[model samples]
Target: MSAIQILDLSNNSLSGKIPTCMGSFSNLHVLDLQKNKLYGTIPGKFAKGSPLRTLNFNENELEGPIPRCLVNCTMLQVLDVGNNKVNDSFPCWLETLPELQVLVLHSNQFYSSVWVCSKTKHCFPKLKVFDLSNNRFGGPLPAWYFENLNAMKDVSEAGTELQYMGEGFHQDSITVTMKGFEFELVRIITAFTAIDFSNNYFYGEIPKVIGELDSLLYLNLSFNKVSSCIPSSLGNLSVLESLDLSSNKLVGKIPWQLTNLDFLGVLNLSENQLMGPIPRAPHFDTFGNTSYLGNLGLCRFPLSKECRSDETLQPPSKLEDDAKSSIGFGWKVVLIGYGCGMVFGLIMGYLVFSTGKPQWLIRIVEGEHRKKGRRPNKKRGGRRG
Candidate 1:
């Protein structure tokens, strides 16, 4: 009915195409048909000025491109069409929706690069959760889009009241891959933020701008063709919890700056061209050898590969070498002088004793006795008196 405001048929065995008329409702704020057997393209032609806020068609048998007509619903917030058969390019057009927050298009046939939309200055300004994994999206990481994720950069805590993300009537949720495990978050809080761009064809050096999102919680760029050294600027993410850059073409030593993230709990830099000793710290120490498994050049406690002494110790400078040589020569000279002194003393003693009381020794003793006789002991004189 047109009067219905919220329609939730998720996690059901409902089959057939989604009713086109449902998009016509003026008051419909939430439409959830996730985890269903629905088989058809999503209904296009959402009414202009429609108050629809949440549209979830995830894990369905849906096909065809995402309906562009739904852009008319200016008040839309959450759009999750993940784990479906939808085939389309990156939906850069959705940047028009100012109120859009969460966007999940993972496990879909979405292809092409997520190129910047020149028209929109502030794209997805309030987007907190962005999951585009398991798609055919290629090209370098979208630094343009990341630059405008103002919501993630600055999370507002204006109200003292705490609440999950959703219309008051229906609590919104989504499945996310975190720390190498799939987790179904039933209630997404306002502070929760994650960026999962893994399992894609994206290549090139990960943009350094990514470190600017200081408030980010989970970041996964794994299973891509991304190369280059991990940025040291990522240490700016003081509150970040999980970071996964595994199974990529990343090279160079793991940045020591990452050790500054005291809150980091999960770290996976495995299967890459990374070399050198892994950064050492109690936090990094907790991670097992598996974290640096595929990186043969990585060494330290987590890995059995010990760094060679030459690799760990620096070569001595010319000045240091000269100082060492001088010290060694000085010690050798002192030892030679000591040996000569000992030999001279021993030879003099043998000559004096072998003669069985030499005349020089007897004369010196007799002269000392005469001087002692002339100078009487003061204590002895006092006793006599």
Candidate 2:
């Protein structure tokens, strides 16, 4: 019926192309057919006055470029078509949607660098989550692209009120890449910011402008051809939680400035061309050997290879650790025995002196000497006979 707005047949065995007639539901807003056996491109027959707000075609066999007609729906907010066969270039035009919040084109054949639409102001200014990982995007990360991520720059309180990806008629859920896997987030809040551009052929220095995004919580640029020293400016991200730049050609020392990130929990700079001593701060120390593996040129605390100057290294080692344990046990035994003997001697001496040389107490003290004193007399008598 034209009156029906919400349609959700996702995760079913439905097959064949999405019915073009379904687009005639001018009142229809949310369409969710993800994780089904659906094939063919999205229908391009939506009405110009389309009220579609949320469109998710994730985890299907849908291929080809996204339907350009869907852009007619000016009210589009969330577009997630990840893990499909869609082979197309960057959809910079999607930035025109004023209310678009979440865009996921991960694990597809999307290629080329991202560009700004107007070049005068930010695009996707309200975008909270952007994932383009596992694609064919190449070239140095565009400077303007990072500059226009205005949403990533805006800091928000972590304990904000409850929220969801979309507020309109939708399936009420979407999948996002968290850490290194596809995770379905049932609810999303304002402070849940992340960027994952891993598994691409992107090369060149990571833009120092990335540090300007103070609200970024998770960032993964692993499995790329990125090179050059890590920008010391990244230390400015005081609240960032996870950072993965592993399996790249990145070189130079892990900046000591990174120690300033007190809230950093997960870090993987491993399998890189990095050298020199790793930063010696507490936060850097928490990460283990795996975080710095494959860097045979590296030296310092956590790694097995000691630095040229071991003064800066203070990693908890096994040999010295065993010595400390042995000394601790030996000293404890001595103290207990000495304490018991001192208490007994003091009590006996106090009883004899305080009781005016009490014979019983004095005899206990003199008993040893009395026996030796009598033994000498018996020896002299036997010698005289």
Candidate 3:
């Protein structure tokens, strides 16, 4: 079909190699062949100037490196080739796709550092969602990796109207691990920005620049070798709902500023080097012990291990007592003021009335009689005869 614009044959039992002549479909804009028994490497027949926009070849027996010719499909927006045996390194060239938005390379043989760009100049400018979990990607977590996600760095994008991903008939889907659970998002939204690098060999500190992504809704970097203090800058994520940094070497006090995340509903910081008292009250009290487990240094609230008097510096219970004391002190001041005012009123009244006032009372009565005497008698109505 030369005029075929959308070709979707996913979730099927079909087996065999992909057609090498798919490039012949000059008008094809969407191609999906995921969740099948297909084998062999992807054909590098994507002709130059092809109008392809969405390409999906995930959940298959496909092997070998991704077709480098995909770069020719400059109009491509979504590329998902996860859950296959595709042995390859991170596609540093994909950064050139001006229209690319979503990239999923999870559960694959993709390895090595994804630090393609040294500067944040022109990499994944419009990308909203990225998933590289369960891969062989390793090395230090570079701060530039997050500094370049310009789409997520803006807080205003969250206010934009949400739009579903994918084109007509064929919907895009990605399986993401969030808050320690794998969730497959079938109908993704444009405002739904996430980063999943879990189950990797990444080490070193999670970049502080990561906290600059204020528009990010979900962030997962669990099961890695990340260490050092969890940056307090993460409190700036006003829209973040799910945050997973568990199973790392992170240490130091849980940043109290994290309690500023009013929208955070799912938090997993278990199995880290965290210490000191957990932040108290309001947002933090809601989380279960699963969030602070394995970190013996993390004490108080939800955890049965009580910290020393110095360790639990400002526990929630103490904060409550302070609030109550302040209220009581304010009430005491108000009562004292009221008593003083009442005594003053009594004294004023005593001074005004206790004075010899018999003359004043008589003058007031005389004035009323004088005014009455000055009035003319009123004639009865209807008495004219």
lDDT for each of the candidates? 0.87, 0.81, 0.85
Order candidates by lDDT, high to low: 1, 3, 2
lDDT tens digits, residues 1-385, model 1? Answer: 8799999999989999988898888899999999999998999869789999899998998999988887898888899999999999987888888898889999989998887457466888888899999999999876676788888888455345677887477899899997667889888887788999999999998888888997799999999999999988898898899999999999987887788799998888999999877777678688888788798887767677789775664334447889999999999999999999999999879988788777887899999988888967899999999
What is the clash tally of candidate 3? 0
Which stretches of model 2 miss by more than 4 angstroms?
Answer: 116-120, 157-159, 167-172, 310-385
Measured by lDDT, the strongest candidate is 1
* Residue range with the least summed lDDT across 10 consecutive positions in model 2: 309-318
Instruction: Provide TM-scores for the models.
Output: 0.79, 0.76, 0.79
Error of 3 at 232 (Å): 0.5
Residue pairs with clashing backbones, model 2? none
Tens-digit lDDT track for model 3 on 1-385? Answer: 9999999898899999998887668999989888899998887888889999889898998899988889899999889998999999898889888888899999998888888545547888888889899999999988876787898876665557776777455677766776656677888776788898999999988788988898999888999998888988898888999999999999999987789899999999999989998898688799999999999888889899888888867634447879999999999999999999999988867866778556776788899999988855455433542
